[model samples]
Target: MEQVPGGPERQSSTSGLPSCYRHPGVETGISCTRCERPICPQCMVSASVGFHCPECVRGGSGSGHSASASRPRTVAGGSVAADPRLITKILIGINLAVFIAVQVVGNRLLDDLALVGRWPPAPFPATQGVAEGEWYRLLTSVFLHQQFWHIGFNMLSLWWIGAPLEAALGRARYIALYLLSGLAGSALTYLVASPTQASLGASGAVFGLLGATAVLLRRLNYDMRPVIALLVINLIFTFTFSGIAWQAHIGGLVAGIAIAIAMIHAPRERRVLVQYGACALVLVATVGMVVARTAMLT
Candidate 1:
């Protein structure tokens, strides 16, 4: 949503402390220089004059006149958000929560969620795999992780990479890029990996973010060497590591690059449609892969 500043003053809570405009439960004394709304540390963006809320930093003149009329847009033409990193933070929270659930519930949770092409050797009821119609695994596996180091590396990469991309592309576009990329990865794994081989983790989504970051940096005419080198190192790890799901990483990377190009390069006139249409196309392709794979497995 487009954040408009300088609206009629909002009321403070019963505690007499104004909450951060973005995060309403958190009380804060700090206020945005332009909008004058209370801002917590997370919502605070340092400006030339003083601290401003994310919305004020992104748009709005301090004078409060024509603020709505002059609202700024991100590089991709998405509205500037009140919290640039909100989606990224929430994603991290969800992954962490899922990881904790897996730990407490043990392998059963992993069994139910991880992507499996066929699952359960013959003689077992064909009741537990993607081919047998447990299609949610394609998306669910994107968040499933068993090892500490795996989730740690993935979440760290996600925060480092995803936050900026989220700000640049806006929440709607960024999330589509992430989830679709992950699904692309899962689809590829299902298409290629052993039917009974289970795979799960956020690496696919994180790789997608990494790929999107590379595209965004190139779009902004920023230095390419750093991201290129990072990609090289990660690719080496993907191929060299014994247990890594290279298919998912590579699949997600390709999809992310494709989606990012559409998001940032679509003609301004047809931007939203082109951007989201690209996502829909990717989704259809992934579903196609699942259908073909299911038919083969069945």
Candidate 2:
């Protein structure tokens, strides 16, 4: 019934200190790295790299932190290590695995598993028609790729951009951007591509990552010209390259740019919500455009 003046009730056998030095009645077995004091679970605060004790946190030992951990020590570095961007790497792995399975296992299996587009099938059963079925493709087609090169390029880009972006934004926001961007890309493709032509890839979502990066860099007061140049070069290449889905690229770019702007410019705590809402609006607009265009075409 007696509470320690400043410590938690629970005592750590290792330290013999109450869980938290501040709340002696509360039990916190974790110790602070800076102060080396036992911390109650409630009082424990997470650093970018590790957990910190309440005293260390109050004294600001872990504030304004940069990643001191090396690559292998980074969150994705080891099996046991905690990387803030682990989800990004896992997503890349899954995509790569899918690509390998498709190439090695053959298109027959892929077709069976492929995300179907809105268009009805042409004379060929494998080539489904894209009449009204475009809505389904918005979500599914991102997982499907036309060739090894297609998936390979997208996955590589995802790894290059997704990891850092996820690290900066955190897992939930990164995943939201990716999915929304992919959907936006597909929706754009449906809007512009001939209903008779079926297309699939993750380019749109990857572009969204680029957009997110642009926003992040700007928020950090980094130069935007380099990013703009990179985007321009890629867009030019898309136009020149055969079989590249320019519509998807443009769609993703626009969506990503919009999301990034909302995220970077919005109030600090509201950035994530604004970014998410912007992407959702873009998707809805893209779908509406696709539907309207399809009706006009028919």
Candidate 3:
């Protein structure tokens, strides 16, 4: 083969010699780097070691590792991704879609999508916004935002926190933390909020993820001053803001911390079951609180 600057390799044909492996009709003076069989320039694949046949390149299993050199294999569910930030991007997309929807529907969207604490469940309070059985509000409310700035801030928080936290916790655990944190926030709201009020936004989940990130960073022995400072500022804002739901923030933070602790401290042998069980306990506690509150209201 002859070499040229910025051009396809050209092959010098030999009379009555072995032809290209891929194109038999085409005669050439090239050979497979490993098998040594005659080949055409078109079939030659450039490798760090040497030029190889297309078959060897695809199989990655020929002589001198020409065949065996392939891409790294990734496991099914863990650490198997070209881009680790996929879940974070998807979550941001969902949040943006929900925000647009809420704006399109106006007050009706707020009434239906936001979480409202319901009490005196008989005919559902006339003053209550959504119907009595709309339990999904506990989750959907986390994605609903009233104003452009509200969504812009919450989405920004989620974008920052979700990437790191998801990287540390893995997709499944990260999703669990997000959803349960939202539920914890909504449940705490149900326990403390008046039936006349409606609550919405992703602050609870964002705070929960921040708490988880802090814990993970601490576990890794990384300095947590930035995270700690952010937490303190958010806490101060929660308390100082007029309409902020400090209860939801506190509830989500506590629940996230609890779950993160359980997952981190769990033994390797029992980690999966223990992490899931810890999450179940949090959910159960939230449910029990809501039920108890309902009974008291009744």
lDDT digits (tens) for residues 163-249 of candidate 2: 766655555656777887777787677666665555667788888889878876665445578788888888888888676778888
Q: How many clashes show up per model?
A: 0, 29, 5
Q: When superposed on Cα atoms, how far off is each prediction in RMSD?
A: 11.1, 15.2, 16.8
- Please write out the lDDT profile of model 1 over residues 200-262, one tens digit for every residue: 987878888889888877864555888999999999888876777788998899899999999
Clashing pairs in 3: 60-67, 60-68, 61-67, 61-68, 62-67
- Which has the better lDDT: candidate 1, or candidate 3? 1
lDDT of 3 by residue, 135-177 (tens): 7777888877877877888888888888756755666777888
How would the candidate models be sorted by TM-score, starting from the highest?
1, 3, 2
User: So what's the TM-score on candidate 2?
Assistant: 0.66
In Å, residue 267's CA in model 1 sits off its true spot by 0.9
The 10-residue segment with the lowest total lDDT in model 3: 1-10
Question: Which regions of candidate 3 deviate over 4 angstroms?
Answer: 1-80, 119-131
Candidates' C-alpha lDDT: 0.79, 0.61, 0.68
Off by over 4 Å in 1: 1-70, 123-125
